[model samples]
Target: MHAIPVSQSLPETLDPNIFSSPSSPKVGSEPQGHITEQVQTIWNPYKNRYRVLASCILSFANGMNDSAPGALIASLERDYNIAYGTVSIIFVCNALGFIAAAFFISTLSTRIGRAKSLMISEALLMIGYTAIVTTPPFGVVAASFFVTGVGMAMNLAICQVFCANLANNTALVGAYQGAYGIGGIFGPLIATALVSRGSKWSRFYIIELCLAALNFGIAPRTFWKYEQESKSLLPQPASEQQDRERGTVKRNDRTKRQWQSFKTLMSNKPTVLGALFIFAYQGSEVAISGWIISFLVQFRHGDPSKVGFVTSGFWAGITLGRFTLSFLAHRIGERTFVFFVTVGALILELLIWFVPSIPGDSVAVAFSGLLLGPVYPCAVHVFQRLIPRKMQISSLSLIGSVGSSGGAVAPFMTGMLAQHVGTFVLHPICIGLFVCMGISWFLLPKAERRDE
Candidate 1:
């Protein structure tokens, strides 16, 4: 694709520098009088394939990290002699970790470059995994997840920014997310296999440790020169002296301007609505992935070994749906497609709740994942269309951070509620989240048709 000229129509009140570094502007940043060059796509420069490969590996690790909980929760409860509410503390801590990382990830990436930021993220994952694999006290185990949450949040934010800036961004983002689903598929499969075969629950994280170590070794090498590439790719309008002065100004007032931009984003209807949509979307998605195995075991009276694989089925559906259905989202219209799928997922959720049979619930759960898989990418596509290009990075960063918290908050709530009422509460909570998604989708501003 030909590089498009940067639009000069950005509002004076917004700060383009807030969403990017002093030297490297984000994909749509408009520096005065200069055109923004597009980032290299996988095909345009074959070297980017290495970067994409690394990102997929990172995402796959994340998928395994997130999905393994459902399969292992039973083992954790059994081994630790903890109740559902007590065991759910890990989810709460993990959420806090993600929230903590979200606030710093942008600034961290800016100050240290993407390469170092990703390395630190991997390091954090290694720390978390190391702590977990030792089968320390339950409190220690929970705290370790917080570290992993921080790591995963940083990795996700940076990789997403990279993919979103690529040519054929939608396709790249889909593949990136699909890798997560593939990891999701394997995570439960591996965890379930290990636990069911008389291994301790904590032993499962050894595999995660190895995965994190692999990424840690690869990340710096693959992304070490990323910022230099970005600087070269983005056209510089100002001379060296002017650029130095601009950089100084960015350093002096970066935090203040970023705060102001964040305030502006909060008040924007489309951004708020978009965040809410994704929040509900991920809440429903994670709630299912994290709790469905427990639900099957408790409600269906299915064996833990057998029911554990149901989570894998759900993630497998997500993987397949992301790969297959995401292609159709544009043709069907994202807004309309999301509405249909939300309704479809809600119906399947109802079937899962009402139909007590394990076989029937398992099928419903997988199909629900299939319908839900494409919503995230499609929502992002609509956001790209609706939000101003200059503010897309910050807007999306905020949206993703908030949405990830939903993943934590909803499951935490489910775990707590399940302690008193039973695991059946998962269905109602997910159903309600779907309703929230539909409402948020309804409230979002219409996406105007525009050329990329």
Candidate 2:
């Protein structure tokens, strides 16, 4: 793509020294001119494309890591001679680690640049995966997974925030998030196929580590180049400028403002509602994705290889749905699209629950993916538009953390249900959950204005 030139509209009187350290702008200075110029430059159509690609790479990594454990759960249980309940504890630990990191590590990213935060996350992922591959004790394995979760939380929070900032037109945020869903579709299929062959699960992590490292290496050059070109296009401060030399004061103020912005985001009803949508959607998706193998093998007497294909079909449906909706959402409107998708998902889940035979069950599960795919991306698009630009990261982080928690909760619940009520009944409960989510989406107040 051709590079879009930065806007040349910055105020003439701004001190040249401001360009020296883009990291720390002077405190107590009005940022009107700087903010405007930066928005104009960074919001170019070309920059959004790069950001979308980067976001996709991050999503691909997320998929590989997220899908690996569930796919390999039976193997781990067999190797360790552990009960299903005991095995499920691994996911609990992973979720706890993600929750902790999302609350704390995500805040740190604002202080250090988003790029630096992502680099650190990738490095930690490498270390965590290495620990897992070493065949440590169960306790050690749990710790390694926990660390991986931490890295994942940071990576997810930063990438979502980065994508929001890069969006030029409000209508395209769904398209950007759709790229993430596309990654989710492929990551698990590839990971599961590798694990099924008796290949070491650690190899999957190693591959992901290499991909993340490459992304880290290449992103900075492009991001910085974009930053420089866009700098002149940013708005200048409207308030009197502080002395450019006082770096400490500027840093302190920025930190304070970020915290305050976080508070405001937490207080907003629309933000909370948007997060609930993510939480519900992810819970439904993970519950089905994580347990489908077990359901087929234990309840239907299906082979593992066939089970993997069945699960993969679901993901394939999701990928196709996301790719199509990325462009289609612009024409249909997000609210209407979300309502339609959720209702369809609800219907599909019910079909999966009621179907008695393998053919019918498989078809329902695969079709569910298409119906459920657009819910997440559209919800994210809504939240991004509702919240202010500066608060986008904190808002996305908070919602993402909640959403990840849902991912954890659903699988854990399914495992428990499988242990008690019998594996065959889990599908019905999932159908119920989708119905509730669809009802909620339908009832959610429509956006009062297009640009809100």
Candidate 3:
């Protein structure tokens, strides 16, 4: 099979310096002087596998950070002597971090290269973890989450871009995200167990601190060579094309070129649709996960201890769908499969909304998670296929970070609305979001290329 050309989808007027560092490298930049000049040699099997493993770790860390926030709320409020309303600021701060990262990470990735960007992110994460473990003032702890949020956004975007650019099969993407699902399953269990069993709640971050340290070690080794492997960085493989791009844009004007590309991508049909699609999808997913327990207890009069275990079932279903269905969707058709999955999830959500049976609602909740799980990775697969390689890192990051804010925003919105009405509204809100998801999917332009 022939490799898909990275520059094929890139605009002809694209700047050569978009992914290239200046000739005068910064003091800490990875040495790129020995980059090879062979076109075919860019594909290194061993290095490809190494990058995939690094992406898996990145995803796991994403899950580790995201899954614990809900579990920590009571602990954070009680231990820190903060009000419940004040503790909610943690989510607000984290969401702000994601939105802020979207605007800057593109420039950061372009200026330093993806490898160095991730290293900085890891360092930031370590700092955030260390601060959080101290159980400092509530405000300080909330601020620490914003620091961690920036780190996760950078890593998440960079890794998604790196893996997507590798142009490997969608199954690899499935497995990468599937690792996050596994981590999500484990994170809540461990966090809740330790807190409930007399362990200090803040101690959970010590485990994450250790994980961040491990990521710090793994990231540089796997990604430092990205400048050498990623095709768009230099024109060495196509010396003639290099000469042409050089003639069109000057070195000092590269930032202008980057912004131009960003504007074009922002206006593109697929990119816009992709963002809204993920916004609704993430909202649907997080709302259910965050509110299921309250919905079960408040509306259906279920036992808190008994119904809490149902969240495990929900997460388990998600993990299974991500690992299994994401791969299966690739074989069938990502777009078609996703449309049907949303429909199935819609059906289950209605069951939870209308039926008063706790056991029935519990089963519906798990099935809803099962169906919702594959949507994220599958949408990613679609985004990589539709968005040009040149814009994907920025666009995917925009989608990832902006879309992730939905996880926080949607649940928070549900909680506020539920206060006036009731927990029963969770299912209806999710259903409305899923319907928006369907519309977004319908509006998305068909992929010019689909992985077969």
The best candidate by lDDT is: 1
What lDDT, from 0 to 1, does candidate 1 have? 0.80
Evaluate model 3: give its TM-score: 0.82
Ranking by lDDT: 1, 3, 2
Compose the digit string of candidate 2's lDDT tens values, residues 124-200: 77788777777677788888878878777776654554454442433344444455555566666776787778886
TM-score of 1: 0.92
In model 2, where is the ten-residue run with the lowest total lDDT? 1-10
Candidate 3 residue pairs in clash (backbone atoms < 3 Å): none
TM-score pick, better of 2 and 3: 3
Model 1: CA > 4 A from native: 1-32, 44-46, 239-243, 246-256
Model 2, total clashes: 12
RMSD for all candidates, in order, please.
Answer: 5.1, 7.2, 7.3
Clashing pairs in 1: none
| Candidate 3: regions farther than 4 A off | 1-45, 77-86, 231-256, 300-306, 388-390, 448-452
What would the per-residue lDDT of candidate 1 be over residues 120-203, giving only the tens digit for each residue?
Answer: 999999999999989999999999989988888888877766777777778888899999999999999999999989999899
Worst 10 residues of 1 by lDDT: 1-10
How far is 41's C-alpha from truth in model 1 (Å)? 1.3
Better of 1 and 3 by TM-score: 1
